[model samples]
Target: MSLRVTFLGTGGAVPTTERAPSAIFVNREGDRLLFDCGEGTQREMMRAGTGFGIDHLFVSHLHGDHVLGIPGLVQTLGFNDRTDPLRVHCPPGTGDDLHDLVHAVGHQPGFPVRIEEVGPGDVALSADGYEVRAFETTHRTVSQGYVLEEADRPGRFDRPRAEELGVPVGPAFGRLHSGESVELEDGTVVESDQVVGPPRPGRKLVYTADTRPRERTVEVAEDADLLVHDATFADDMADRAR
Candidate 1:
């Protein structure tokens, strides 16, 4: 399956006519993950054609613009009768923030939202042969970046070649695919290495949240298929952003 990334909001701190805030949509195998739900994130998601019901939301920081839309999105999902649980991930103390927001919004019922505070070395989401890892980022407050990667897939076995050699499709085929020697009923031996192709390489995507330039960010983005870095200002204003 192909992994695609859509920029929901690209502006930082402020919303522009062309860009909203800091939100992105990572689509993998029909799963939609939101990174940083800044102001107007729900509207931006709709504009980007990304359906509602995001299963996972990764908050880069506790900035107002970064997380201000959480309460609204939660209410919207409930209003639309969405039953699937939503998971929110951020640094420590994020649960308290979410709880306070929910309370401030009058605690809408029927929408189950799970808030998880995470730090470096945390796995935000893992399933369907893919995983997302969170790493701490340098910023005024606690922040983090994310790395999404696909698990390695086993090599494909040349079943047609085996069949042409009169090998039956049964336990012997399983053994050959699993890198083991298989002895046929007629005393013929088949080796896995002869039938299996090279293993498939995994794909990786990295997102650098709001943070100053640092070596860790470069390391996190190493060899990534997609590397998204926070560039809030022009090159001349780099020092100001830092």
Candidate 2:
């Protein structure tokens, strides 16, 4: 699996030539997921060549600096004829703001826009390969962070041996690779051990928008492959953050 994370904007609260705002685009094996789309994020995405392929946008909170680029992204996807449903995950009780964002693009999009208010312990999105889990985070306003957890992959597949055993390629081969036993046309029983390896761990990425350091964030980000956090203030300001 190939995963790439592009920091579209890395500045906090303000924008400059060196940095735009707070947005991170992640390409996890071709599934694009955006985290905290701040202002001008669409332009940043355009410059980075990250086309409007994102089907999901995870907003840490409803702050303007954290979610201003949603309209541009929505309109861009609409213009490109993206009929697939777009999902937005945000903090609880943000439906009104979410509605404003939905209608900000002049005309409604061709696809359905589903917005779900998420909080700690809520599983926003779960797929076969990975799951997005929200955790409690402390900030000036109510916020929730996200953790991208990948599922353990099945053991390695023995393609050469499967081919040598006269097993035809395709669905059957896929099933065998997934640790399923298959019977060949010659009545030979093929065991999963002949084609499957051991379980392997997957990569993890955690993103915590504007927030004070907390134990929950540490627990969720333990041994994460990538961690994107907002250190808005320096060590001296830590007391004020609390």
Candidate 3:
């Protein structure tokens, strides 16, 4: 599977006509993993042809422009009869913020919503394929960035090599591919190392929501196919953004 990233918004706290706040969409296979639902995120997703029903949302901070549209987006999805469970990951105080916002918006408590507060550590979401790790970022609040990755990859197995050596295909083939020697019908042994290639690396995407330039960001983005950073102001406004 391939990973595609789309920048929904790249502006700072304020939402301008030319640029919105910080938000991005990481397309893993077909799942839409959204990072930071800033103002106009849902609209941007609609414009980008990203259908509704976002199951995963990661927020960096509780800034108004960063999180104000979350309730509306969830409500919009619910209104559209989307029943997929939504999981939200954010800093320590994000749960309270969400609860307050939902209450303010008069949430009926029928929508499938799950809010999780994460710190700088590994977050095991599921075993099928998706996993996210939250790392602390140097921002005004308890901000964090996330790395979303996919697991479980099937690589090519050399079946012709085994057949050339007169090895039969059976459960023994499975064992051989799992790095074990398998005894064949005619007392022939087959080794896994001879028929299997190296494991394929999983795809990864990193999002740096809003932060002053830091070395950790660079390290996290190393070799990542897609790195989404916030350039709110030009290089000259480095001091102001900090």
Per-residue C-alpha lDDT of model 3 across residues 93-122, encoded as one tens digit per residue: 678887775555577545677888888775
Model 2 lDDT at residue 212: 82
The TM-score values for the models, in the order shown, are: 0.85, 0.86, 0.81
Q: In what order do the candidates fall by lDDT, top score first?
A: 2, 1, 3
User: lDDT tens string, model 1, 138-174?
Assistant: 8888888999988877688898988876778888888
Q: lDDT for every model? A: 0.83, 0.88, 0.76
> For model 2, what is the C-alpha lDDT against the true structure?
0.88
Clashing pairs in 3: none
- The superposed Cα distance between candidate 1 and the true structure at residue 206, in angstroms, equals 1.1
Model 3 spans with C-alpha error above 4 angstroms: 124-126, 150-155, 158-191
Decide which is better by lDDT, 1 or 2.
2
Model 1 clash pairs?
none
